[model samples]
Target chain A: MMGSLSGRYAIVGVGTSRFGKLQGVSTMGFTLEAAKQAIEDAGLSRDQVDGVLVMMPAIMGEQHGWAARVAAYLGVEPTFSATMDLGGATACGSVQTAMAAIDAGYCHTVLCCFATQNWPQGVAMQLFGSEFQVPYGDVGAICLMAHIKRRQQYDYGYPDELYGQIAVTWRQHAQLNPEAQMRKPMSLDDYMRSRWVAEPLRLFDCCPNTDGGGACIVTSAERARDLAKPVVRILGAGQSHSSEIIHPRGAEQRSLGGTKAATMAFGMAGLTPSDLDVAQIYDAFTPRVVHDLVAYGICASEEVPEFVTRGNLTFAGRLPSNTAGGLLSEGHLSGFGHIREGVRQIRGECGDRQVADAQVCLVTGYGGAPHEAPPTVSYSALILAR
Target chain B: MFAIEKPLPRANEDTAPYWAAAHKGELRLQRCDDCGHVRFPPSALCPRCLSQHHEWVKLSGRATVFSWIVVHQSQHPAFNGDTPYNVTIVELEEGPRMHTHIVDCPNDQIRIGMPVEVVFDRVNDEVTLPKFRPAKSK
Candidate 1:
């Protein structure tokens, strides 16, 4: 019965603002630009969109009733609206929430969008427990990610060069993407020589904060068929959150909440990992790509080091991933770029970065405060097909 | 030159007891009376059994280093002078992992599975943080 819901809804249109450092664009300005582009991309007027879901940027400081505010700004009074907070997972989560609303007949078309004016804020510092974590100087997501990388090194003994290889591969893809932020060619040496943000996690390993926004219009499959763009069916969607205050003893240390989510998504789609033509795994950090590759069943844990080092994630590799350079090379829209890339890839619209014969694509989003010991990490997955 | 004040941990009702025990130079955790599960950053009920009846139990201050990171970048101004300090996670013998600093150990020497023992750092009159150092030979 659960599988029956697969492919009932589709992403009819996707849009993104110019990504990179910019002057004078407010947060709502980016949102309105992306939303307007998406609405136009779908060949629909503002009045046609009856639902809105918004994810506020973490650095901007959250606002109350943000979804309603976004709706009001757009001159759209959405009947089904909500503001979602899942961190990086919010983009994919918003899409899934839109699908749910459309399935329940609450509304026909839903607009999901996120945008922010980039600034150098310690977004993760205040999230640590004031008593336990803050006192110990455990601030920032990079520190927590460094701990996970250290743990992985101890357990799997993978070479540190594996991370460098992943970084270089994504950067190479970025060079082909005109809109990518850091399009300069990066060599493995450049990656190794990069300054450390936290030991084992270097500057290149972290995604650059940029001013950007992304929006997508989701509607029922039947309605999408009439839209201007090709209907990219939502074959499967799954989300999993592991809220642990501290890393649980005897639990798999490397299991970062993606396995269960992949199981559910792939199950709903009646497909397997090998069937995917492309993937857009979240790349907040380079090691995250490795962890998600293993966690999503794309490859076994032991095989990931060699799989990534041997260029399996490149556009010409067996499984082309993050074709538009991902959050690492592409501008960070907090996984919204991943969603837009997935939709565009399925529609065969990407000029140079497009994968040949791409029919199925997978997009994943991950975010949370790892220091919270609720180690509250959330994973969201979407399987989009032509 | 004026020294910047470091941020202190704010304790709530659920975690007040843990801070109080640390102030007294003793390591304590909440153990569920029903399932005997010990938890830290204390919660109101047992996660394993959802039992509200729990006791404040003293612990062996012994732990093993689970993972660690050296700070090359400080997010807060107060930590600017402590560049390249080590923040560690140590798993207690009783099965709870915690975030603390591993004192008196060089950042490069810190390794996973290193044996450690807790030491209290009294930052102020009210707050005493539980830290760790390399364990001496038993």
Candidate 2:
């Protein structure tokens, strides 16, 4: 079924609202702006959008029927519409959901979007594991990711310098991206000096809080060829979720569902990790890049520290990654910015940061159950080809 | 000013027994009668065998540090006074890992595979949290 769906759908257009702090915009306001821009980018009328999928940020508080609300606000009456919440995985998951919907003939030309205004409310409080974790001060993604990084250190002998290297490289890419938030040049010395948010995770290891939104239009590959921008084909899409929580005896603490999802995606696309020209890894924290690198079969687990240190993620390297700075330097639009960058990279639209002759771009979405109640239980992967 | 400031675990039907045992200075978990599987955070059915029949069994209060983190930053206002505390995941002898704090040990001294034993701390009238300390012997 997955194999048959490959190369059938494509992301024709992508757009985003302001990348950094915008004082006056509401969450829905950003969503509308991104959606409108995506419609314009595709050279399609707003009335032609018949399907809508939206992800409302948890930090902004939950609202019922957000997709319906977005559809109503955008003045589109669609045969298919729904809201999804898979934590950080929602953006890529939205694209996968739209592909499935289109394959099922439920609707065509789906607009998938997500935006958050994480101000005043501050960082999202750990809500799921409140009974087990809150009293112990095991709150927030920083602490959860710290636990994973610390375990990785114990199991794989990964050094803090390896994580810092990832931070430094992504910031370098951010400097080239005009839309990136933390564009200031960062050095390894600067990364080492940054304050620690958690013992194993420093301040620079985390993504910043920002108010932003991003949207992309998904339709048949044939339809995308008739659109305004270059056609970035969705060659493969795969998603995997686990019921395992962190406290269980057999819970997987070191890695996530990326391996299973990536396997399915690669299988559907009939490609291997060697075919990827560039990647947009979900870097809610730095170690996620390491996890995804191994999970996607890009390199052996033991080779990750060395692979990253060798400048493999730099623009001049074999496989450039997070070219738009990822969530680490791109400002957090969940993983939407990663998707947007993936599309742009495939289109050869990334001016200075573009990977030379980029063809296959891999974008991954990770994170669910914020505090590792089942750390990284949800994962989605998309294999895009030009 | 004397009120407890930290969040407390609220016991529902499946979890009340575990808390009751903790209040009595014992660590009890649900053990499946059919498959002999023990579970935490109390559930109705066994995750391994899907068996509904179970019993509350007291453990030896022994565990080993599976992983840990020293929180240099506080996420909640109540824990601001306790900045730089250690939150560790300890694997119980009965095979369930739990999220807890390690007492009587410096944050820097905690290591994976270090032996520890549970010690209950009664925070108030209704709750007693199970914390760990360095064990006298393996």
Candidate 3:
């Protein structure tokens, strides 16, 4: 049963704390700042928000029960609350949950917030590594994706240079935005000459460790129409899981769960890949973007190389993606960056990197390395319309 | 006995047998008695049939590199001296996969689908690691 949630709820306000190394603030501080800003930006008082969805900050070893903590900090008696821990995928998942809850009349105004303190604190091992993975020196995030990309290169005959192209595009996109962390212009030569963090996956190929938070206020469409900002409708939401195998023992380098999630999201929205005017896709790694592009049916696996080469991901390009620079250059607020970027693009609030006439924006979040449960890895997609 | 200071696997209730076999210099995998499906990283239930009844069976040790990554940097202090090591996932001949390192081969020469065979290394009295080297024969 494909139950459509098209136009049932909308994101009335979006706010983010300063990205990059947030040294002075704790996770709670960042979350509170973003949450309050989001509520105010929606033209709603804290009392109006009767529901809250929070992403637990694990990078700082933050304790759980974040929903209750955040609710108490904000002094709101929420009717509905939840704490999501899907790694980087938490933001999109929270948005999906908030939309469903509002549609079900659980609550009218809900605040979805997430904060990350992974900047100085390296969480590569704690976040992705399992018992089997940690002991074997497969602890780094770059190592895991590098292994995956190596397999992709072996089977698909795709050159590693394709990843270089992706890195270059994001660096260029980041250079235009003042909020971007790494604004240095990256030429293909610069990308090639960069040191390898893991073989075949160079330094530039990985997203910088980030510390920040972002929050969005989701409300019913009728109530959102009376808010402060232009309403961006939550057209569809979906999530899926692929192989639990961290190292899939096969030649196939594609992602199954991501594709399933994308398909479900498009199906629920009654939209196609072409209907998307912009994509705020997760780019923790360049290869991830490639796999996600194929999984979302934006292009076939075999055609990824040519597709990436021909279609620029910049604001001036055909299918603009991650116009706010993405995780590569933008501070990794986890998936919150992607979701907030989608909202901003649809609202035409992005100053220089905004995609023109973007009516429908696709936002996806992916995280975790594979394990027995694929425990941490999750894929969540949101299709938003202006 | 040489000191084995590196990180070693601490076998739990389900994985003790797999480790015991490794201590005996033998490679074993869990096979579901119900569905006859084999799996690695020994678990309580079979991935295929979800049956708890399983047996630890010996493997041929013959495998091929499914994928590999060279670690130029490491967060673990034990691997500080081995920064340029190669970690690989090899598909065993018995249709199961294991995480081990590819040794006796240059980092530059390691290729995907390259044939390899297991070489057990007793790191400590309590632990023995299963590593892979270029296979002499298929």
Candidate 4:
């Protein structure tokens, strides 16, 4: 359909540093740890990685020249080295970039890596909001999302518990993930009683700010078969960025612009939503999970409340989602963790949370709310196949 | 007792006139002279027509609450004492929207599409911010 690059490259290996509060490690330290693990997981030496793309160093207070520095630290001297800044979308953003580079013969193997220090001194709020937003009290992502949730409630009478259901489901998924940061079992009661971060948005409704890093290696599909791990080809990838300005008065202001990207990905892969064996979606906030699911056409817009109500989000359910507990519980590596989990699912390595007979996985990254008032401008989606 | 050091907006050339009008108790927006399209968060050129020519026009700050969020917790130091305050998206009558607070109305009574009008509140010595309150019936 579109000038297709389907099945051009595959994700050979994925890695993550311990996700919780790793107090003493610097950003570079975490990046190096994840990169080393990824290289080993791919069964390739450090010298074999000729391309490196560092994503969002600013989230961890790291300085500029990140790719070159990471390259130097790993002692690889990659032929292609740069940074990709797409806010929370950087994970899938990096995968799409690596796929294109490999197809063009720019580099053989590319390592995409990222690390963040878990909302150190409100860094997450500061990184996304602006002077205009702050002065007027559009403080954090919580408030921004709360506004959208309230709008949806106004339009559709969606109950407040709908978001709680998402939080509850992800917490269940987290219970099975040893690497997840917030694995404590939560009931609807816990979700209901949680303190309000923003009105209509309780504490549990927001993702825990996590300190960690995640990395994945991408190379040509042909080379991936020869590597150590089972191959997971990146079948299709698409990204779209719309309005940076948040139109406060517009209709349905929650538009993340992800539909464009998701549609393109489905077209490029020649696949439909029904083909997805599992979905690893970005959940920076719980409402985002609902919004993205609708955007991806996995469920009808009006059916979201009933859809999530059916408990179909668990690993054993009709539509397994965020099997790694997502940023809400899996720890926030931006969206990098989502990509890593997609690879794991395709490889059937998720021991406790593995979906049965999984073959195709859909992963998405949505972020870049430039001002607290705007809809998310950046969206990326990738289809990974075993 | 508590004090709030409200964050002041830094106005540049693109936004200086808008802020200046707010200081004078008028809500003004930039209208493209060539295209007749109004704009907010003032910019150098008309987004639709790409016309650099524009005029600053004042509008009746009458608006309705399009949507709102009650902030129970804030990361900013200035708002720590003001928990449970509302940040509203008000659609102005002239067809622009602004992020402003609704005053003189209880949190429970605020509703979408409720009419409101602007009231200037001085935040600092040099800056005056525009806030809104429930409008009386005609």
Ranking by lDDT: 2, 1, 4, 3
> What is the per-residue lDDT of model 3 for residues A284-344, given as tens digits with 9 covering 90 to 100?
9888898788889888888888888875666666689988788987868787778888998
Q: Which residue pairs collide, candidate 3?
A: none
- DockQ values of all predictions: 0.75, 0.72, 0.56, 0.61
* CA displacement after TM-score superposition, residue A225 of candidate 1 (Å): 0.7
Q: lDDT of model 1 at residue A71?
A: 97
Stretches of candidate 1 off by over 4 Å are A120-130, A249-256, B1-4
The segments of candidate 2 whose C-alpha lies over 4 angstroms from its true place after superposition are A120-128, A243-256, A372-376, B1-4
Residues B26-126, candidate 2, lDDT per residue (tens digit)? 99999999999988658888878899999999999999998898888787677888988998988899988888999999889999999999999999999
Judge candidate 2 at residue A233 and give its lDDT. 94
Candidate 3: CAPRI quality band:
medium
**Over the stretch A221-336, how does candidate 1's per-residue lDDT look in tens digits?**
99988989988999998899875336573466445578888888899999999999999999989878887898788888789888988889998788999998989899788888
- Backbone clash pairs for candidate 2 read A246-A373
Off by over 4 Å in 3: A119-128, A244-255, A369-376, B1-5
TM-scores of all models? 0.96, 0.96, 0.94, 0.94
Candidate 2 local lDDT, A236-289, one digit each (tens):
888888643354635363345588889988999999999999999999899788
